[model samples]
Target: MIYRMLAINIDGTLLQSNGKLHKSTKEAIDYVQQKGIYVTLVTSRSFPSAKKLAKALKIDTKLITHRGAYIANEIGRPTHSSRIKEHITYDLVRLLEGFPCQIRLVHEQFSLANKYKLNHKLLSKTVFTTGDPIVYSQQFVDSIGDTIADEPAHPLSIEVYFEYKEDLKDVQEAIGKMYHEVECIALNDLRLDIVPTGVSKLTGLLYLAERLGIKRNQIVCIGDEMDDIEMIQACGLGVAMGNAPFEVKRAADWITRSQNLHGVAYVVKEHFRKQPQIEFLQKLNIIK
Candidate 1:
């Protein structure tokens, strides 16, 4: 059937291997928009990061960011948020104090421990950037400090990045057992994310659906990572990219080709083309 909205993940799902959107993907999205189906981006990146992609797509739709801890519009206006409790935040900071791995705190953005150190460089590369580490790190820390100290309210979300895959799992398990109120998800082999319980891409999509007056059965979600698990399963048509892990593929209702091959475009076109036929048959109660 014709879906009312489409929720697509950013990193591996939309952008190509080089972190650029393929021409075919953009054209397919344009085609769907012209058909009056709302397209929204669901991602783990912060609003600032996700903004660039949204702008590139010419999307005026809502964004789910910080792994679904925060939801905002294209212009970065908060529509909903779920934050780690203050006590839990302090505990997390304490837990990371002596870890061997690099620690970066994310509050709408990322901040490394040292402004002018190798840690910052490592983090930027791991997170998809080649900018000056000193400048970026200082700016990030300053932003976080200001938010924590001056803002009347605490940040709505926080994320800590680890360098190694093994370290990430250890930290995830430790945090999971320590704090019963938080949710920890390992994004990939190299990254781990923690958010408040019940806050996820699915939660963000539901919030958006409520605002748009659309039902769950009228949505389609596509992704290729662990964070996308909940969203894909919840959507009426849950799709996993061909490059997605075995578990992710198993969780999906359908698996499209690899991202490098314009997988997203293929899936969108297939759904868009088939939706009309399904709707027409249903209208006549052909099989129902």
Candidate 2:
């Protein structure tokens, strides 16, 4: 089938190891755009963080962010936002009481705990692909204190990250028992994202689809992680990168090459090329 729109995840899928968009990938996107296909990016990163990437791709379509809790256009304007209920946030804060881990409260960017110590290395590593860690750190310090606090007035989203998966699961289970109002998703072995219920990449994509007057089956989703699973499965076509987790691969409709190996470009070419053949066959009334 020829899809009218394509939604691709940024990290771990479209970006290379050096955190740069491959020249081939950019060209492929331009090629598809010239052919009249719409390309959009769906990511967990905040608007500020996603801006530069959106600019690079010349995307003016809506962006899915905060793990689907928020959806906005290329200009960082919000189309929709889902916040965890006040009571749920209160419960979550209590649930994390005394837990030995780092928690980031995400509004648009990351807000760390007031007393939180700087893990300079980890911070640098995390933002290395996105932006300057030192600059981000300064912003965090300037906005919210070093230690994260439970401010009912704020009513923001939260991401709990642990150094170990075992601990993260334990915390996940602990919070899961108390509140059915939130969603807990593991992005990787090291990160767990907790957001309001019904908030996911799928939700964000659906919102965009509605705005664009496109049906679910007319969209293609691509990603390389478990968090992308919902979106990939929901789309008419789901593409998993070779480096994606086993579960993600299994959930996808098709598997592509590894991210570092031009996997995105390869799959895009395949999809675009098939369109012409289908059109040609339709013209001949062959199998129509």
Candidate 3:
């Protein structure tokens, strides 16, 4: 089948676990673009962070970021943004503050966050995919809820990070019980991106695809997290990394090599091929 668009997740699908983009992966993305396929970076990362990576990849297509709450291009102008209502943002921040996890209210222009001291090992996870503080306006305050009350900020999403695995689990369960308007997505064990109820990577991609006049069956999605399962199931081709968890792999149409193993490169090379026109084949008397 012919695919026109490739929507790939960043953390575990494109970039390696070590947070580096491989040379092979870059070449593969370039090769795919030459084939006239639109490659979109669909990720839970902040738009600024994702834009920085997009620049490195030389991706000009608009990006899906903040777990699909914000869709923007490399220039940082969003064509779409689903911000949590100010009241809801305040309530969610209030609830998240009860836990030990750090909370950052993510927006297209800036991020408002609470300062939580975490172990050195867990600190990298917070900074790596979220954004560089210097590049992005990441303002740390005493209380995010207070900031919300004072400024009435409407954020695209709320990012939470935990030092302990159990805190992540507990917050997931707590949010599940308390809020009906927000979705708590676990990008991995240490992080969660909570967005407005209807916002998700799949929904965001579908919106973009519709705007571009691309059909659902003409898209290829590759991801490695629970939040990724919907798009993986909905797309024409769904790919899971070899390093992906068992559940994510099970939902995919095919499994590629792990991120560290140049999985994106392998998938593009193996699947993208020249399609023979039926009329041309018939004219050559190859088949009926």
lDDT of 3 by residue, 119-215 (tens): 6485654454567565678788888777777789888888888787788888889888988988887877888878889998899999999998778
- What are the C-alpha RMSDs, in order, of all predicted structures? 4.7, 4.5, 4.1
Q: What tens digits encode model 2's per-residue C-alpha lDDT throughout 127-218? A: 42222343233233332321334345233367665655687788888878877888787766556678888887888889888887778887
**Candidate 1 lDDT tens digits, 120-188:** 345556543312243233233423333444433234444455655677788888887778888776655
How many pairs in model 3 have backbone atoms within 3 A of each other, for residues 3 or more apart or on separate chains, i.e. clashes?
Answer: 0
Where model 3 places Cα greater than 4 Å from the true spot, the runs are 74-76, 119-128, 162-178, 186-192, 276-288
Among all candidates shown, the one with the greatest lDDT: 3
Q: Quote model 3's TM-score.
A: 0.85
How many residue pairs in model 2 have overlapping backbones?
7
List residue ranges in candidate 1 displaced over 4 A: 74-76, 109-125, 128-153, 161-174, 188-190, 274-288
Q: Clash pairs of candidate 1?
A: none
The 0-to-1 C-alpha lDDT of every candidate, in the order given, reads 0.72, 0.71, 0.83
TM-score of each: 0.79, 0.81, 0.85
Candidate 1: global Cα-lDDT? Answer: 0.72
Per-candidate clashes, comma-separated: 0, 7, 0
